[model samples]
Target chain A: TQLLEQSPQFLSIQEGENLTVYCNSSSVFSSLQWYRQEPGEGPVLLVTVVTGGEVKKLKRLTFQFGDARKDSSLHITAAQPGDTGLYLCAGAANTNAGKSTFGDGTTLTVKP
Target chain B: EPEVTQTPSHQVTQMGQEVILRCVPISNHLYFYWYRQILGQKVEFLVSFYNNEISEKSEIFDDQFSVERPDGSNFTLKIRSTKLEDSAMYFCASSDRDSPPEAFFGQGTRLTVV
Candidate 1:
């Protein structure tokens, strides 16, 4: 089974702070996706990085896929209270019907 | 902004009983998937369905779990028998492409087996 591990399981920061969360794995995947989930809701797709060393920006959030496709990172610039949520990274194998392997997730809390 | 939709936001069933979760994926999406997350745990992939059949499924999707796209738009997951451990939030998602498979998920069905 392919596993994705996320660091700093819980994070709390004041508004306007910047924080970075990471997702790592020993397996290489064809694509990696980042999602944000609110309480009692399913995860919403944030972004998908398909190429190695690729970077994508969604307003205040920046996502990057490692060169080897075994890891990814999410960075928030001047995080606001609205940015607080559970951030998850999922890796999809090239084969296996494109099923994604998810990380435990990093729960971020931005206090206003 | 199209989105997936799931019915019966929450379900409560007794152990050994059967349950069927329903989902209506985005109209144009061709790939549908089901995933579950135990409280405070990671979202685990359960099954993927395409072309009216299952394409792939995780080991967690044992014989007790089954999926069917009975109609063109409605996808359903049936658990033959429920156990306490089966309680979790079940999410239905769909995507148009496969390269990255950027999926959109529904609000989810919270299933509790008592």
Candidate 2:
């Protein structure tokens, strides 16, 4: 089974601070996605990186896919209270496989 | 933007009772999936549906769990008998053909088995 591991299970920082969360795996993925979930709600997709060494930016959030496609990272610049949530990374292999493996998730708290 | 929608945001039922969790994926989506997250745990894949049948399922999706697209837009997950361990937040997701792997998820239903 493909497994994704996330680092820094919990993080707390003052607003305007920058933080980086990492997702690593031994299995190479065709694509990787990042999601942010609020309390009591389902996760909302933040971004998806499909190619090795790919980088996508959504405002203050920057997502990078590893050169080997076995890992990814999410960086938040000038974090705000609104950025606080459970961050998740899911990895998808070939299209025919038909399923994705999710990481344990990192909970972020940005105090205003 | 279109998003998956799930019914009965919360359900509380007695053990051994049958329950159906309903989901209506985005209108243009072709791939549908069901996932569950136990409290404070990572989300786990339950099943994936495409072409009117199950395409894949995880080991956790045992004999007691079943999925069906009874109609054009509705995908349902049925649990034959509930147990205390079954309690969790269930999420439904869908993706359009243009990017089948980029899925959008619903708000989710919290099931509490008593």
Candidate 3:
């Protein structure tokens, strides 16, 4: 089983502050995805990085995939209260079949 | 954007009782999956279904847990006998292709076994 470990299990910051969450694993992955889950709801996909050293930007959120495909990071700039949620990173192993393994998750709180 | 839908957003059942959680995945999706998140814990993969059969399943998907696609649109997960440990938020997700994994998840059903 592949295990993805996310750093900064809990984070709290004032609005407009910046923060980065890290996801690391010893096993290599074909792709990595980031998700944001609000209270009482399922997770919503934020971004998916497939290539090594890849970076994608969506508004104020930036995601980066490691060169070895064993780690990923999500950075939020000028965070807003709306950005507060449980952020998760999932790593997909190269398999003919199956869903990806998810990390423990990072709970972020952006105070307005 | 089209999204997955799950029925019975919340369910409360007694121990040893049977429960069925329902989901309707996106129309174009070909692969389906089930995952559970215990409160304050990581999301765990339970099973993956494709072509009307289980393509993969985790150890957590024991004899008590089963999945079915009763119709073209509805996917369901059944727990034969509920236990206190089974209480968690169960999410149903779907993906269009298997090569590069990108799954869309439903709102999830929160189950409470008392």
Candidate 4:
């Protein structure tokens, strides 16, 4: 069984602070994705990084895939109250894998 | 830019009752999936459907659960019998062959078993 573990289950910070959430695993994956979910909403795809050592940015958020494809990270620069939400990472074994196992997620709270 | 859509933002049912959660995946997507998130818990994969058949399902997807495409656009998940433990938010997702790993999810339906 593959397991994706996310760090800092909960984080509270003031506005303008920078933070990073991590997702680590013992197994390699062919692809990984990051999602942000607000209350009462589904997981919204933030980005998908397929190559090891690859990085993608979406405005204030930066996602990096591990060099070994066994881990990933999300970095938020100058996080504002609007950046607050549950961040999740999911990994797939290969292109054909029907299901992607998800991490427990990190709940981030940014206060102004 | 299309999105997956799920019906009945919330559902309430009694123990031993049957409930069917419905979803309409993106018209052009190929892979469809069902996942559940218990209150304060992580989202877990229940099953995956493709090509008019079930491609994969997690251990949590037992005999009590069933999934069907039913039509060209609708995918549904049926719970044969409800239990308190089944109370959670169910989300439907779809991805296309162009980018098989980028999945779009529905807002989800919150199922409460009384």
Best candidate, TM-score-wise? Answer: 1
| Candidate 4 segments exceeding 4 Å error | B98-100
Give the residue spans of candidate 2 off by over 4 A: B98-100
Q: List where candidate 3 sits over 4 angstroms from the true fold.
A: none
B1-114, model 3: which lDDT tens digit per residue? 899999999999999999999999999999999999999888999999999999989999999999999999999999999999999999999999876778899999999999
Return the candidate ranking by TM-score, descending: 1, 3, 2, 4
Ranking by DockQ: 1, 3, 4, 2
Classify candidate 3 by CAPRI docking class. medium
Every model's TM-score: 0.98, 0.97, 0.97, 0.96
Give the Å error, residue A85, model 3.
0.7
Q: Note the DockQ of each predicted structure.
A: 0.85, 0.62, 0.75, 0.64
Model 1 Cα lDDT, one tens digit per residue, A5-111:
99889999999999999999999999999999999999999999989999999999999999999999999999999998999999999888959999999999999
Residue pairs with backbone atoms closer than 3 Å in model 1 (clashes): none
Which sections of candidate 1 miss by over 4 Å?
none
Q: All candidates: CA RMSD in angstroms?
A: 0.8, 1.3, 1.0, 1.4
**Tens digit per residue, CA lDDT, model 4, B44-92:** 9998888888888899999999999888989999999999999999999
How large is the interface RMSD of each prediction? 0.7, 2.0, 1.2, 1.9
Q: For every candidate, how close is chain A to the native chain A in TM-score?
A: 0.98, 0.96, 0.97, 0.96
Query: B12, model 2: CA deviation in Å?
Result: 0.8
- Clashes in model 4: which pairs? none
Angstrom error at residue A25, model 4: 0.8
